[model samples]
Target: MPTADPASLFWFLFLFATFVWPAWERQRIHLRRLWKIHELQRRRGTRVITLIHRQEALSLLGIPLARYINIEDSEQVLRAVRLTPGDMPIDLVLHTPGGLVLAAEQIAAALRRHPARVTVFVPHYAMSGGTLLALAADEIVMDEHAVLGPVDPQLGQFPAASILRAVSRKPVAEVDDETLILADVAEKAVRQVQDFVRELVADKLPPDRAETIVRDLTEGQWTHDYPITFEKLRSYGLPVRAGLPREVYELMELFPQPAGRRPSVQYVPVHDVEPRRRRHP
Candidate 1:
């Protein structure tokens, strides 16, 4: 190999320092700026959208994203609470048709005893068991048209009204033993639920006011699906406020109302069945 010339080496060094190195450094700075820009966008975007529900499907293929609360929802609620910062307040956006009374009570109890304040925001409706939990919040905020329904316990698939109606329409001795027993249980369940509702509201309302609200909700004065409007709840003397934050409606739009039934398979292609021939030797 020929020995390197000083002139060639000098030119090479000058070109690297003058052009190549500057381009390389400039590219590196550009990359860093791009990273910061994306990072800033990600940070700001988090405030507008909930990061916990980044994907509609997180895990458990059949479970809902955030549609409603049921007896099965305790684990999800606990997980949400665990993931949240302890110092931050818990804001529950409720829109449910209610579920198991016990589960609703557990959720309500958690809200009542949380270390930080709990606020429930109802976008559309939170009925039956949903109303039970709303009572536990320090502040319940709702959209103008949002509703909270009665907390009358259901007997299996039938409403308590069916059972109560039987008792009201017929004398005790005239009714069958099994029917009488069921009616008694239903009456007791209604009373117990009313008392529980009162207790849940007592934290936010005075004892007398709480009693009135609970009585109205559980006395079967309204149908189970009744839309106890925001204005109606406010008149009941609970600390119910109208006008929810914008974020609540934004989140509501994110979830489509849950469809309980699986969609039926719409189409089936016609095909002929093949028959095998039997040979007798």
Candidate 2:
């Protein structure tokens, strides 16, 4: 028999080992580790940290359903964190679209209760509740483009419903009356949000200053691209500082103490925790 074509044999083995075997192995490893983490969470009481993103109607593939942090889920995580030894820090990686006000308040309260320091990492934007959660953190780390949104409470109601109610109740062509009614509605919405901001931030800032900040953030012409940048946050009399990505990276390597030092939460990419697989030719 012609000596087995050495090159063909090598290619066959290489394909089997590099392509087929590795793919199967990777899947197996992924599933195994996923199960292991679940079990570990169930068994050992460790520092429980969660990632919250925007709410989507549906989740694609294995992507996590993003929404404002769920109050219930936050409670569960807080319970777990509370179980962790007091000496261990609870590091929460938060990226959120800022969800329900009540939920955010609950999350903030839980963060406050934990004996260990709560460190929040904002790799990207964390608006509304995300910003509220960051306030509870001993330190907050932000990337260059990362932002926090105005803590404006957006009330959701059908504009059509409101207009119909007004039309049914009031005489037509009373333009001045209609304008005053609309202004009143707008003021109520602004006041509601201002009250909440007062509760969260007033203790940290002077009462009058806090009220003024809330008014500007909520009453100003809203913009989708608006950002509560570090400069703006400081100007509002909140304790905030600029964080460079490079500085955070170095700090992560060093793992310095957070207290007294400026809050230095690091933005860790998901790939840093779970790297992508390479394909074999």
Candidate 3:
């Protein structure tokens, strides 16, 4: 048998440490996340699915890439929903900045048809399409400070409402053909979302109340990036509650945002605290 050169052995080990180790570490974190998800499932007695889209630095230059609800996400979620028994409840941990409306609508429609209860957990914020998905849930579980956002459609880079507003301010002939076309599409988009939202909440709320909810969310009452706080959602009579499972929070930790050169936010991880008593004056 020929003996390997010492230099070749040393370089092999060096390359493995530099490249292979990171891949292995990532796999370990993935497995840990799965374990946490299973633990949450056992505690809640529901099938747990996570639609978490975190920004990650995937390139050598550490350029952060954003993730969102897309066709692939919708496909996977629909598959998971189908695999679950009809009688089994679903707990969806949703953390996204929203994505394609078409994909989101597909997911929401499937969840609406599910026979068992569907709960959406928002550990942070779920905007646009994310909010659309939450609307399908029987109950929305949010962190006290978590937020939802308007579902008004976006036409390219502009809000559909904004497009219509701009066109309405100008005379029909003054508007270019392209602008008129966009305005037409915007009108239809807004109406389509309003009708869909009404359908989603019809079983849960009275007709008048459901219409109100639909208008507030899909009629561009607020900016597309507006944060609908827990309190505001409650004021609207949405079936939203505060409090998230500890396991869910732990799971979020495993899907961390990509680290920059220096940490943007940092704090000591103090688990529990007792308030300090004031001395009598």
Which prediction has the highest lDDT against the true structure? 3
Better of 2 and 3 by TM-score: 3
Write model 2 residue lDDT over 1-281, tens digit each, in one string. Answer: 67889999999998887568756755875566455444434443335365545433321133334455677767776676667787776766567777777778777777766777766667668887778777766666666567887665554542322443454575556657755566466556656666666666666678888877766665544443378776666677765655633423332332222223355576877767876699899
Q: Per-prediction TM-score, please?
A: 0.65, 0.55, 0.91
Give the lDDT of residue 260 in candidate 1.
Answer: 44
Instruction: Report lDDT per candidate.
Output: 0.69, 0.61, 0.92
Identify the superior model by TM-score, candidate 1 or candidate 3. 3
Task: State the weakest 10-residue window (summed lDDT) of model 1.
Answer: 46-55
**In candidate 2, which residue ranges exceed 4 Å CA deviation?**
1-48, 54-66, 84-89, 157-192, 244-281
Q: List the residue pairs that clash in candidate 1.
A: none
Instruction: Give per-residue CA lDDT, model 3, range 22-126, as digits (tens).
Output: 688789999999999999999989999999999988844678999989999999999999999999999999999999999999999999999999999999999
Candidate with best TM-score: 3
Per-residue error at 124 for model 2, in Å?
Answer: 0.7
10 residues in a row with least lDDT, candidate 2: 251-260
Candidate 3 achieves a global lDDT of: 0.92
lDDT of 1 by residue, 148-194 (tens): 89887788876676688868898777889888888888888988897
In candidate 2, position 126 carries an lDDT of 83
Q: TM-score of predicted model 2? A: 0.55
